[model samples]
Target: MITGVYSMTLCDIGNTSFHFLENEHQFKVSVEDTIEHLNLKEPIYYISVNKDGEKKLLRKFPNAINIEDKIVLKSNYATTLGVDRALGCYGYSDAIIVDFGSAITVDIIAHNNHLGGFILPGVEKLKEIYPNISQKLTFDYIEKINLHTIPTTTNEAISYAINAMIVEPIKINYQRYNLPLIITGEHGKKFLNYFNNVFYEPNLIFKNMKLLLEMEK
Candidate 1:
């Protein structure tokens, strides 16, 4: 177990940003920013999916500890599963964890075992696809969409398709597993409209990181 939980600094490096939790304070910095600029002075326990960012962090901050290998969980998922997704499902016995970051990952944990999951392009990434297809398809981001309604306008059509693509599959799995939905990551809250018995946990990964640290000892 951690000797001083309150003083522990945890960092989660993603493709787009570096998320830091120090004490009870949480903040983020862009991956493009210089690592030395943070002026961090504590021993940091971190997990990262961004190879470039991880390298820079380790090179710049000798105090930064890479704890990806320390996370011990029984998963039926292939060896290639992302650590973020694995940790997201760590403490849950039965749940569908949908993480919306640079990519959307849906992982299932049943009876404390990971049953594998699927991935899709995230909101921002999906938005870029239509414009590539045709400039006329370009539209402003829509925060809310009605999947039941047939879209009439170009913008509504794009929004409907995006929401349908992301939500429909998860809804199918939710019905199959009959598990509580756990939503997390940067864009996770935007999906609250589509499900019942759902939870929004922005700090799910960080919470599990602490659990993993304890288990490591």
Candidate 2:
């Protein structure tokens, strides 16, 4: 109900899936993985993500303050502060952040940036439409295969389509920006082989919240 957060729900919406982390004194998710798992009921801090697999999450949370779309941030850089801090930690700024999530988001961070990133359906999004429209295509996890360009088989086609769409746009944008480029989220590491001078961070949004909270007072 209020604008401020006692706990931060940092959600990174991608083309494929949503990855979120809750951080204040600690970090946890509805589903446990890593970090210090905390008790859910008395959670002072909260984080929720609504990505590819589940769309219901976006509707489910009682306090669904749109981390990006629902709220207009003062600066674009603040939009990506979570992982930006990691980049800053490595002495880099003014780069492009292309997160390959449920939706492929191409964002331009102008040295000291602002929010309002371009949101596009991820590589798999096209394939997800296959059964209804194409009737000839299929889907598969892009990481397991070794190929470039679009693959020939249905499975391989999914792989190549997602990878090429995901990678090429990044290369073009990074070159145009001529600054450091960062690839993060679920699909980021899968295609790390094709790109260079890029950084891969798994928990950027969560880490960003931790860093921002530390700076307060």
User: Each model's C-alpha lDDT?
Assistant: 0.87, 0.51
TM values, all candidates: 0.93, 0.59
For residues 75-140, could you state the per-residue lDDT of candidate 1 as single tens digits?
A: 987799988887888878899999999999999888988898999899888988998998898897
- The best candidate by lDDT is 1
Encode model 2's per-residue lDDT on 1-217: one tens digit a residue: 3357555455544322344555433332342223233223322222333343234443354344432322223353443443322332222246666666656666665645443355566655655776767666645555656554445677876666656656666777677777766666565676678878877766565555445444432
* Candidate 1 collision pairs: none
Candidate 2 achieves a global lDDT of 0.51
